[model samples]
Target: MTVLPEWPAGTVAVLSTGAGAPHAIPVSTAIRRGDTQLAFALALRRESLVRLREDPRCAVVLLAAGLAITVHGRAVVERELERIAVVRVDVESIQDHQSPRFEIDAGVAWHWTSEEAQSGDAETRAAVSQP
Candidate 1:
């Protein structure tokens, strides 16, 4: 079954088009199908929808706390006239940085942000130091 990272990965970065740069955004929600597939619920007119229509190959990244999960897959945008659809991904690979390892296979790699390596590092860095 598709497993969530140690922390909740609430957003992903996506390319607007096949050859465009990555654009990251917080996803509205994600739904799991069985154990190896996932569908991201999104509005039909979003940038991700436009890009997926032109090219089904894309990477979906999930970030939370300090862990990042990047999945490469062939995406199918099942859109309806109602302007809403699910971006279904036939997961080709999965990756994780921090873990005892994810429950699901068909994974690629794992990565931990610098902040995560040291708890509250990001927050500490963001805070102004009192001289």
Candidate 2:
């Protein structure tokens, strides 16, 4: 079982390359009913994809109100574009800064493999669609 962080909806997320620089963007995301999973989409430029191809490790910082969640994981470029690329971030470790006893666990991150994600989504949809 994986333990995930608790973050509210519509939070701003800061994504940092393996380098020192960072980019902040508003997140349109989905979190599992429990703290088990999370998924978000990010658009990037050709340069960004190239950079990620060279360095797959990245960090995501989510902040809402005063609460914050910091996650470290591997990033994958799903689609490349002239002006934009779609990137998926798989959480490796998640931390809640506001919590005194912050939790950091493996559930934060996932294997960013297309097959795994697609199969998981298919199964989830099937289960949900069942009466």
Q: What are the TM-scores, per candidate, against the unseen true structure? A: 0.56, 0.52
Q: Residues 1-131, candidate 2, lDDT per residue (tens digit)?
A: 14665655434466667543553444334332344334444445434455567888876776655556677777765554343444666677777676657543322322326987666544433332222
In candidate 2, the residue pairs with backbone N, CA or C atoms under 3 Å apart (3 or more residues apart, or in different chains) clash, namely 91-108, 91-109, 92-109
| Residue 16 lDDT, candidate 1, scale 0-100 | 25
TM-score of candidate 2 relative to the true fold: 0.52
Candidates' lDDT values, in order?
A: 0.53, 0.53
Candidate 2 Cα outliers beyond 4 Å, as residue runs: 6-9, 19-37, 44-47, 80-83, 99-131
lDDT of 1 by residue, 13-81 (tens): 332236366655555245445345666655666886776777788766655555567767787765443
Note the clash tally of each candidate: 8, 3
